[model samples]
Target: MDRANIIHDLLDWIETHLDQPLLLDNVAAKSGYSKWHLQRMFRSTTGHALGSYIRERRLSQAAQALRSTPRSILDIALQFHFDSQPSFSRAFKKQFGKTPAVYRRTPAQGMTEASPQSSAQQPNYHNESPNLHLLYNGKCTDGKCTQWMGQR
Candidate 1:
């Protein structure tokens, strides 16, 4: 398999495993690459660091849960594997520019994209948006280069 395929597969795997522990060491082991190599390859292909991508995806999924469920903020935070409600709140606020409670109270339409800007060469990602199709900026013979996450 090529580097592109590896990255696409990894993205799908990451999405499906978001609720679990997804530390970089574990992800590197799963990818059969050294941490250094994997980081370099992932950053080169996706224009985002592997760790940052995982974090943003988790935050995005948490945002979806917040909008669609009546679950408590702590529950949502813990569900997404955050260390604690306060940590979750800090990351959430950093990603979405609002507290989870405020975000839940606001209408979805009132929300704006608060994700970090993609690099000049890659497609953009919305850090707290729901139902994103994460595309690998590469050439693929098959249409397996995109991974959809946070789908309702």
Candidate 2:
């Protein structure tokens, strides 16, 4: 097909096969484009370049491992085909602000928290006028903005 379609297919293939080593030649052959040509097109169209996209995808997987899996950093790195934990950590930090361990410390990290079950629990939305939108700087219950609107 076209160049963009080829690259998108290649990216999808790479993401689906993240646990394996993704080599340039292998990718080139898969997309029926030579290494140099595909690399150039991939860099231009995606704005990320091939290597960055793979590393970013790996880092995202590593982050999920940090959150959901009991595997250690080294184990996760090895699983993602990174040579060492340090390399994985460096790449992870580059992609996301925090290190894997820091992101995993959920209660202390505050990355996730209890959800607000209803509109009453949140100060941003109101219960009485359900589904209403308000832009008040002060507490919303006062109806001060409504009064101001009426006067004008």
Candidate 3:
């Protein structure tokens, strides 16, 4: 298959399997490519390291869980495969600009309420090539906050 098609399939697989251990070796095996080659293709295609994308995706899901679930921060962190709460907090803060606890306690600006349904839905991701930037602007519309994916 072509590189674009291969990358698309890889992205889908990664999304579905986010809850599992997704090491570079594991993903490379799944992609039927050497780790080095897969990394090159992934970076050239997505403009981000394969590992970074996976980590960001996990962080994104963890953010949703934090917003909607009564689950503890540590539980959420563990669920997303972070090694520890402190590590999870560091990554979460780096990505979302708030520690998970603070993030849960303070509703996002312009967002008045959290819906359980939103937590069940997947975060918005597209199949386009090139880099993406997740804009968690907390801009609410019709009582729902939206996260936007933009070209980098």
Candidate 4:
């Protein structure tokens, strides 16, 4: 397939797997490309790193959940694979210039894009604590977050 087609397929795959842990190695394997090649191609085509694209999409979905549902910020953050509320808030504020709580309260003042559907309709992803810690925070560290070690 062409580069554009490959990128499109990659994006579609990402969207479908938004609720799951999206590791770079896993994505590379799924796309049948080496991690380096996939990163280079994705960046060249999308003007953003693959990791950045995934992070942005996850944050966008979390924003939707924040605004459209009564779910707690922590639940929304965890649902989108964020390690903690603080880290999620930092990224959310960086991206939308407002915290999730603030955005939920006044969505119009933040990014105004419409969500594809209500977050309520999404399946309950009852992921284990270990998996959540590994995917979101990197290390367990006695199950106490001493610092924001995950991606911003």
Over 1-152, each residue of candidate 3 has an lDDT whose tens digit, in order, gives 66765776787688789889999999999999999999998777655688888888788778778887899999999998999999999987786667888878985676422221233334335221124454432233332233344665
Per-residue alpha-carbon lDDT of model 4 for 82-129, expressed as tens digits? 899999999888876777887778835533353442244332111111
Segments of candidate 3 deviating more than 4 angstroms? 111-123, 126-132, 135-152
Q: lDDT of each prediction vs. the true structure? A: 0.74, 0.57, 0.70, 0.66
Candidate 1: regions farther than 4 A off:
110-126, 129-152
lDDT of 2 by residue, 44-97 (tens): 655446776566556666666777778888998999999888887777666555
Worst 10 residues of 2 by lDDT: 143-152
Which pairs of residues clash in candidate 3, taking residues 3 or more apart in a chain or in different chains?
A: none
User: What's the TM for model 1?
Assistant: 0.76
* lDDT sort, best first: 1, 3, 4, 2
Candidate 3: deviation at residue 26, Å? 0.5
Displacement of residue 132 (Cα, Å) in model 2 is 33
lDDT of 4 at 124: 19
Cα lDDT of model 1 by residue, 1-152, tens digit: 88878987787588779889998999999999999999998887666678988988889878888887899999999998999999999988887778999998988675553433355654334454343334333333343334323332
